[model samples]
Target: MNAPQTPGQSLLEVVDLAVDYQLKGISLPAIRDVSFDLRAGEAVALVGESGSGKTTTAMAVAGLLSPNAAVTAGGVRYRGRRLPIDDDDAMRPHRWNDLSVVFQGAMNALNPVQRVSKQIAEPCMLKLGMTRDEATARASELLELVGISAERGAAFPHELSGGMRQRVMIAMALACNPSVVIGDEPTTALDVITQAQILKLLTKLRRELNLALILITHDLSVVAESCDRVMIMYAGRVVEDGTVADIFNNPKHPYTKLLIDSIPDPSTGKRISRPIPGDPPTLQNPLSGCAFRSRCPSAMSICARDLPELGAHEQGRVACHLYPAPAEARGFHQMGEVTNIMALENLQVHFPGRGGMLSNLFGRPAAHVRAIDGVDLTVRRGEILAVVGESGSGKSTVGRVITKLVQPTGGKLVFDGKDMTSVEGLALRPYRHRVQMIFQDAYQALNPRHTIFDIVAEGVRSLHLVSGHEAIMQRVAKSLAAAGLNPPQDFFARFPHELSGGQRQRVVIAGALAVEPELIVADEPVSMLDVSIRAQILQVLIGLRTQRNMALLFITHDLPVAWSIADRIAVMYLGRIVEIGSADDITFNPKHPYTVALRDATPKVRPMINADPLPGLNGEVPSAARIPTGCRFHPRCPLAMDRCRQEEPPVVDVGPHHQSACWLASTSQHS
Candidate 1:
């Protein structure tokens, strides 16, 4: 490791760093001309899309690049001493002793069979040269420091939740008290409340340890709240570098400005989604001027002929032709008439829990998992209704019931004056033609071996929507174009792997559109996309609603996203609707404490210094099989009272078309 860090000194500096990956004997540029500096107690965020070089740059700095990656130019220096980042053996001594990395996927990064405590202790014993007993004690302390109990450390990775597994990773990263810690999308897969907790923990740790941090993530909201400095990357280069306030307040680069604008901001009223026009440039090609010229709205002739170098502009640095020359700076369409198209009346779906011969012999009762309990909802034509909640809250399960994927154990589903309560098998084919579902993961939902054309044509062919080959091709092309893939022919022959995360999602949307469904059940559609691409996808869905007069049952864990596009919002807690109202009322003037906590947990695109703790929940959601009586959410509710523990609250109408199921709803009404 380098010399001990001095107070208020530069902890790490990377100068003109470049990295290349060997793909089939061809060198592909992953990072080009990246430079940054971090002080002893500073936090910098690398923000961009999937192929934008944020993760690669962070990996290079942490001396943890992949096997095929090579540092072609420049180097990383720690405390004024050069680090052999390219040489794995030479970098070992300094890897965890000075710099550590918390990878993105906690499940994949951790060893499944090993106990979490043993995994955390490995680094301590190996790097610090501590005995087994000392390392074991240190592991317990680290777990406690990360807000996880020491007793839980004895559990295996599979036994923990997503947030707990991530906490274990964080504990492991801080095993040796490293000078710098790099978090690569640490909270990407977590819920809003859990995300807030992790961000809060990292902030607290940074303050206590006085360690510099480099966070690599595409979520600008997270960057706004946690980062001191921001580095915007695009197409293998740093396009903008500045303080958080400078970047968010007055972004100079067109790309940076567009990225900030593309975010789904519920605070703004009735804004339409406008995605960046085109795709990012392919880095494999040699000829290029400005990489963002094709998609930039302010692009001039000079931008196509010459590249803009990173230079000082006002309070920040930006690589844009407009900076040196001049400075200039997802909601559905409302329908004229709205009518109820679908309604759920006291819907309940109870799945039988696992039971075997051994369990029967032991006199164990086979309980049912209450996936959905007493849900009453309605979806209007040409209007979007969003169901928002955490995992296991049954938001997705509600969508499944409406789409007829899962049979409801009890209750009624009325659609277009037809009762679909007990519809199943071949009898449900007609209903399926009018209603379709878009799943969360596009990769898993689609067949990898099939071409884009074949995948889109499958629904059309199966439903007998088109007759001949030529008619089917035309139908597929129309759907693809409607989903925003221009010309459509270019992607027809390509497989799922050939497309980016955003493009793959569009294909899934196209498949859904090919059937020409009047009502679409989208479950976490844009949850996997970058902010820029997410805008495009949301626009496509919203556009469909206007053109086809379609009704959307959007299910997601993101309240802000739902607020941006939905006409109505429903908050779910423990398989029950806790609150329901217009989007504005639900977000701005919530009657339920759960809704209030969720809104507070979401990180905003505003500056906050060592921010105060969020008013989120204190514990995880209870198991469905063993749900608490009285109020299902009472155990984790901050405003719980004696009545809340003894009797379940009845749904009360707080306003016109607004209802809340809380004991204090009567007093909390805005009136």
Candidate 2:
């Protein structure tokens, strides 16, 4: 094995790498013609939506992918030597001290039965030839570097939060002080605050230790803040490669532009979303030309006839015909209206925390979290309503309350024609037929052991809407087709465990629609999906809503996603709706400082960060157990005035459908 770089030298180089899976009847490629470089002390981010071959590339780099998927062609050179990669004996020497990987899904990746300390120490002891005691001491030190305390070392993987488990992953990957580290979707399952901390720790470690890093993610913001260079992959191909600034400021491909436009912004009146329609092609029989041609807004005839090579355009490389050097694509500025639903008066919901069953026994939370406070909103028929906020901003809580999953503690909750704030038992059970909730993680809601037929049929059977197994099967087939799970016959026989993450999610959506819900409560439904797959799933939801004139209660953190489908928008902070209005006013004319900060934090290919410093929100949000005295967001609000500290602001009308809960917007406008 080679040693670390001496001063200035490239640490790793992968050239024209390709990986293919061989089967009895097919030879499918997973990664093709991928090339990138990383110098000592430098970082390169491999960015893409799910199924973009990013993971395949990482697997090749870390020597982890299954043998069935072989690196048939191309090169993975390290420190100028043809990699000792084929045999385990040749690869083991370089596995940890020279290179390592921080896998995504830390919770699942860690051994459930193992103690945190033991898990972290195993790799250190095995790879470094250190004794168990020595490795344990090093593991604690590594844990401290990534934000966890030494005390957590004794805890089991199940005892830790998602963020804590991820930190353990980072600690273990760094236990042997590997020179090159690759992290895949490192923050996918964590909350916004925890994600920030993980990113900060990764950033600090990279700079201070000069370790070469490869961050694999679907998030553009992570790339903007952490990496100097980036590679964008799509359907087993490297579509673009360049410096972070070059790619963001001069995105040359149509797919790249759409990917960037799909993020949501949270700053004024009402925000709109324009999610791309259609799913990516199956890898089994890939199309001849550009893989993105089917849904590309600027696609030309040339794209259908030829596989547009990842040719160069401007400073970076782009793999689309439209970017033949004079590419111009419009994005993120398009938004969609309420034709029917309205929420009247205001709604409030509070939940208790860590209280005994007796506290819940008393008909209240002994200690609680005020999730939705005095929120009045509407969702018109044929329209999409988006609710935006960072995690713990009461966004998901709002969805739960609307779906009647949680009873509101106060105020009116009038739906189509009924007061729903206090509904219970039979009334609520029937409402489940009309209003359904889509959870963030499909796996959480899906029964992994059951076949697709049983999963989707659960809701159908509960309602007792169908007669025999034959009739239930008919309804299941129809629902599956509606969610784009074609060949419903084949899919029904497949279990959730046998399907991909995206496919499992489609099954969940199919289950939701089986009940024939008129109003769907989508709580970060697409957050766990890959960027490209997310757009497809969203488009399906939108199509269903348009056809059925259904109302949507969308909750998410991404602003571009909201702009694509949301008819109107609502921004929540802490437990209250800070602002509500039309998509246009909110996306373009944001008044509240908190809204401005939230929007500014959003990362885009061409970020709106030309002149002003990208706003930095400070201080952790107060724990729900003890919220701030005044404005919940005041501690981090850059525009907080003296009045903001002593008193809370009331909602003020800004436009025909826009209102903001900011004292500044109220005082000047009213006067």
Candidate 3:
């Protein structure tokens, strides 16, 4: 086997790097013998699941490890010179001038009190020995270079949008004209369109400045779209390294294959996807052999006894017992049909905007924000209904309204043949127990001070569904086990803060299950989770839905996810259901222009060198306060006609159980 070679002189080389964190007197390995290189003007991506040490490796290279971490072995060299990264005083001079990092969550990284201009100028004043005025002027120029207006440099971080704030972070990273930049999950919480814009900007800047880039992220699509080379990490080890084409088209390692297959692609219709079973090994415990052997489908007896060295396989390098051996293809689960359990007819939820005192006194009514204006949808037992749309499309609002968290201004909500729109007190209590909600942000949803057992038991006890302490405990344990938190005793006493993001979400689901609800409304349940964990959570949801015959209302903005797990899909735009049909019909034969545009905007796993830019919508989502006249989506629709702008379109049946609200749907067949 051969080691990976660089085409040009190595700009940054990490040789046999190992790092450990000290807690009390115990040392825990966070990164182990990881080696990679970045060439001048090249972009490399580190891809892996959560706790895979991608961030730790980037931090080690950038000399930004926390206080308790120590570099036990190896070194990081820049341009043939080993850097004294551990020594702050020695590395200070070369920090921002030679290398800089755009940290995750730009809003949290920037100072709220200081203006953005000053924040970007700090590196110029300290490292370049520029006067304050000159540094400020340079900061303005940097802002302009990153696509932000120089006049907005005086604004605070809070005043900028999420995408703009990230651009500011990039401008700061390039403040001193650094030759290398490291971006850690730079597009973590951004929408698909904004994410495309950011990736485009990064690619343009890298080419113009000839800068070396290291991007650390769990999104494989992003890596495929923007990176030249790819490195797969797992349990603190670099399992595979190769060009994007080599890795994505023909992976060698089992873990690498699983990671690639786990991604749900809308371009392809409903490919079979299965989450990799089991959790990553805890770094605190030492293992004799491969850390991923327990989860590897192709694991052999020798895998548990001997550790495999990363060696050349095909055109890339891989570390696995079955390196050259082909992996077995896995089958997908098939969903069955069921009867409708809940239905919404002409749901309307409008909120009045604020009006001036003079207008209010004069008898003018405040304008209404049509959050969910006249939308019809349905959920079936043992079925997954995925409602997908961009931000401000009222996807989450529909979920909230279904859960009774927000009352509808005018609509009929039929659950179990009973109208729940005006139900209250005892009537509402029974309905609440029948329906449950799983929020997007698990950390915020779960009580920090409560134990896992108590959090799950709160609903059971409050509803008085069961009697006695032992009975409650039994129910809690059963629910926990159902949600995949096995050996409930181990997690019963743990707090929300002690669990990982995926674990916390499972806990939330367990709480919802404790009450034995027939319907579960999960709003963006796994958006913030890593790819592997996201797959696991989706599997859990599907498993529970089948085992218990419960209905799932999965609300998300990711179209591929909807295609992967949904029985039916409803694409929303400006408070209306623009399209509704089976997952296959919605993905493969989309009728509306809005749905087609969304499908095109989604990023898929492809080679970055010749990949085309996403044909994203032209303008931002129209505000609900003043939605566009006629078809609300006409402003951004590529196929919009004059009639679409002047007259609202009615729902037309395009196929069996398929409907689209577009003017052209009646006369033409769109992609």
Candidate 4:
């Protein structure tokens, strides 16, 4: 039986919480001395890099820790009542009824065979003892409450879009009316616009239902927008905790400051992303003193001698030796001069759409998925042009076309004023040697069986850039060092699986650099990495650009990241570039409604407690196979006019070297 509640207590409290994972026969400490309180209607964010114990602490609170995890020290409390979290049987009644968790991947958490409604209704029926009809009715209400129609509740998870599936998870989390809800990277996999919508929905539900929300996320921008209080965890300890403004504006801890600085904020209008030096320490043994001391730029002798207590600071608590020392300002490096490297004129790439055998048998013409309908773009040497959009927007397809991975259906691919559209067979060797592509997932991109040396030298040997094994080794070492892997000899013998995610990505970059490519097509390179690690990767790219004058065709869904590094930003929707301009123009003075929507969806790092909800995009990007008539964005655009639906808008120059393919661009210019 659960303990009786005491009055006037915090809605939820975790006092000196510590967790350990049983690896083999050894107990590896994952979370150490994490303490916080969550009152009703409060939203707190557990912010950290991967393996920072944010998720572990949350799982302990929700009594959803894995079988191998043990609460070695401390405990969780609900309304002053101690929870037997480690005891699964004892936590049965409290799970989902009082505390609930919306896992990271909705598809993985939800049952594949069962309907979404049935999954949501299962908790309602089992926990609340509601009849089948009652549960079904409640499920329908919840589905509508989270913006999904009740009629679509019968659809399988695969049938819904990524955004809709995430909504279903939210609805299911609220099925039993749980007072406290824990969202574990709920919006990590979503697009910026979709993420904005989900965050808006979560905030609204938290206020309306008077529920306490705990969000575990690595994205600090998301935290600043949705959370009231923020906790910065490093290694396995809560290094800092304070209000959003206090933490973001005046952080005392080095790790906290570095994390905030690492994030690429488009609103800042400065391309400054400094990565923290060194990697996170391993938890094989209990750490002494400060776990972040090795990586701390301002680490003192005292820090190594003793661990700092979470003492009261200015407006919150911080576990750091430097209590009041302000963070030093860093210099921002400007990108050098740029010239034309490549250009695409009316680029078009189309794949055969899924037309079943019946259509072919009926002698009907097959349809094509217009991945890249018609895009006119340019890449300049020593500059980064970011292509930003949601999935199916065809930004990635443009990169593939440039790399010759995907043959263009029509139009021309020009490099250095030379048309390379029909370049094929052995004739394309020079083009391949000049252009290299870096994929999103580095682990999958690299061969698991090959050593780091072999992987890096593969390009050198294939291109025959250098002769002899000694020359190849020298080239590989140089590339590895350039990619920020110092003492390259140490990693030469290691396999992909042996290295960390950041290290693996660095290896991929090293492989690309071994061939000395003139232009690099980086497609979402930093999306899979942590903030600190991402900063490192971004710095490496910027360094390479500075040293080699290498042009980059950077493609990503993150607008802030694009704005942080790119000299120019291109906004794509459906299969066309809706807006193209300088980063500042695209982010600040957007002419297209789609561009405005994307800018609005980007969460800025600021205090947003009880802030007005974001005006997110209306719906997901339409199917590429079924192209919308006229302007593709008109269907979801808030400022869409009658002409937008009836007539295709022509590209108009809105500013100096800035163009927008929107009817409103002309109207705005005239007005």
State TM-scores per candidate: 0.50, 0.49, 0.50, 0.51
lDDT of 3 at 34: 76
Please write out the lDDT profile of model 2 over residues 88-195, one tens digit for every residue.
678887887888898889988899999999999998778777899998898888888888999989999989888889989988888877888999889888888999
lDDT of 3 by residue, 1-671 (tens): 11233446577878667788988755678887677888877999999999999999999888889999988766788877888878777877767888899988998999999999999999899888899999999999999999999999999999999999999999999988877899999998898888888999999998887888999998788978799999999999889999999998998889999998888876777477768899998877645468899999999986775556676667877888786322210011122223478999999999988777987899888789999999998887656899999999999999988999999999888898888888767768888789999999999999999999999999999899999998898889878977878778789999999999999999999999999999999999999999988977887786676446578999999988888778789999999999999887787678888888777777877432222333567789988988999889989876788998999999999998899999999665444
The whole-model C-alpha lDDT of candidate 3 against the native structure comes to 0.85
What C-alpha lDDT, on a 0 to 100 scale, does residue 423 get in candidate 1?
80
lDDT of 1 by residue, 1-671 (tens): 33546557888888667898988755677877788889987899999988899999988987789999988766788877888999889999988889999988999999999999999999998999999999999999999999999999999999999999999999999898799999999999999999998988888888788888999999788878787999999998889999999998988888888888888777776266567777886656633557889888899986775556677777878888776522111223232234588999999999988767998899898778999989999898667899999999999999999999898999999999789998888888888889999999999988999999999999889888879998888789878977878779998999999998988899999999999888999999999999988877887776566445578999999988888778799999989999999887787777888888788788788632233433568799998887898989889888789888888888999888789999898556534
Candidate 4 per-residue lDDT, tens place, 1-671, comes to 12333322368878667788988755677987677888888899999999999999999988889999988756777876788898999999988788889889988988888899999999998999999999999999999999999999899999899999999999998988888899999999999999999999999998887778999998898977788999999888889999999999988899998998898878886478888888888777444557889999999986775566676677888888887322210111222223478999999999988777998899787789999999999987667889999988999999999999999999999999899999998998898899999999999999999999999999889878889988888889989988988789999999999999999999999999999999999999999999989977987886576446578889999887887678789999988998999877776677788877776676779632223333666777889988889888888887788998988898999999799999989778778
Over 4 Å off, model 4: 1-338, 607-614
TM-score of 3: 0.50
Candidate 2's displacement at residue 424, Å, is: 1.9
Residue pairs in clash, model 4? none
Supply every candidate's count of residue pairs whose N, Cα or C atoms clash at under 3 angstroms. Answer: 0, 27, 0, 0
Q: How accurate is candidate 1 locally (lDDT)?
A: 0.85
Looking at model 2, residue 454 earns an lDDT score of: 94
Predictions in order: lDDT: 0.85, 0.77, 0.85, 0.85
- Residue 634 lDDT in model 4? 83
